[model samples]
Target: MKTLPAQLTPFVRSDVTGALLAETLGRPEEEFSLAELGRRIGAGGGVVHKEVGRLLESGVLVDRQSGRNRLVRANQGHPLYSLMRELIQATYGPVPVLRDLLGGLDGVERAYIYGSWAARRHGEPGEYPNDVDVLVVGDPPRRELADLAVRAGEQVGLDVNITRVGRDEWDAASPSPFIATVRSRPLVEVLTEASDG
Candidate 1:
C-alpha cells in the first residue's frame, strides 16, 4: 500500500487500488462496500471511495447502490480481468491469503506480516521484499503452521517464513528482543481471534 502508483507495478494506480483489486478480483464472487474495503486494508474510507470510483469508471469493477451503501465486485467480463487478478495476487495477496490460511486455525491469538515485506506494505520506501516474514502469536501446531506457510508462499510466489512466539513471550512486558524488534517496525495484521468472532 505504501508504494506510490509510479513505484508500484504498472497496473496499479495506488495502494488503495491494489488493495481493492486484491479484494474484489481475488475473490470475484464476493462484494464489498467501500467502508468494508477500507476497514479490511486499514485504509481510510475516502481513499477506498476514490479508488473504487476510478476502477468503476474504467470498467475494472462494477457497483450497485444498496440504500446508502455502494456494493462493488469484480467485473469478470472486463478484458483485463485475468491479468489484474494475477497481478493483484502476486502483489497484494498476502493480507487476504494469510487471512484465509490462518482463519480456521486454533490457538492463534494474533498473526501478522512483519519485516521488509510489511515495511513496503506500510508505505516505507524499501527494496521489494525477497520473502515474507510472518509472526504468529500463540501455540498452533508447528507442523500445521509450516504446511500453511508453504501453501501461502505458493499462492503469492514468494518465500514465507513463519516465526512463532508464545503469548506471554510476545507481550511487551517480557524482555524478548525479537518481540521488541517486531513491535518497532511496520506490521500488517493478518488475522486475530477477535476478528473471527
Candidate 2:
C-alpha cells in the first residue's frame, strides 16, 4: 500500500466518496444502481446516497431510470472526469478494489490489510510501502486466494501477500502469537460480514 502522492490527499474528502467515484466514474464503462454501489464500496445506503447526490449535482455523475432501478454512471463528458478518476485511483482505489475482488469469495469471512500500508493509512508518516499484506480469515483454497491476490495486485499496482487462517484459529479466545502480533498492528479492514461477530 503505497502512500498516494501527498498533494492529492487533500482533494479527496472521504474514502466512501472516493470509492464511489473510483468504481463508477473511474471505470466510466460500467453503471451501478445505488444499492449495488453502496455494497461495492462498503458504505451504508444513506452515505452513498448523499455522496452520489453531490457528484450528480456537480455533473460528475449521471443517473437514468432503467425499469425499476436507476442506474448511475460517470459523466465521461465532464472536463475534470479524467483528473478526478486519476486522483481516486491514486488515493482510494485499493480498499474498494480489494473488497470487490475478495469480499464474496466462498468461505471468506473477513479481510484486513495489515502492514506498512495500514500504518500509512493510519497517518503515520513514511514513504510509500512496497507491498500490501492481507489477512484473510476463512478456508478458501490457497490457489484461489493466490489467484485473487494476483488480480487485485494488478488492479492496485502493488504486490499483495495473503495469509489465511481457519475460523477457529482466527476466533479463538486466546489468539496465537501470530494473531496477537497482527492484532497489535494498525489494520485497515477491507471486507467483513454485515455482522462483525
TM-score of each: 0.90, 0.74
The CA lDDT of each predicted structure is 0.84, 0.78
Task: Give a tens-digit lDDT track for model 2, residues 1-197.
Answer: 22233322545555566668878865788899999887676678888888889889999999999999888999999998878776666555667777777866888899998988777666666777778899999888899999998988777767889999988988888999999899999998887776333
lDDT of 1 by residue, 1-197 (tens): 44376233554677777777888888998999888998787778777888789899999999999999989999999998988888788788888998888888888889999988877776777677888899999999999999999999999888999998998888758648778889989888898767766
- Candidate 1 stretches with Cα past 4 Å from truth are 1-11
Global Cα lDDT for candidate 2: 0.78
Largest lDDT belongs to which candidate? 1
Measured by TM-score, how close is model 2 to the native structure? 0.74
Residue 154 accuracy (lDDT) in model 2? 78
Candidate 1 has which clashing residue pairs, if any?
A: 2-123
How high is the lDDT of residue 145 in model 2?
93
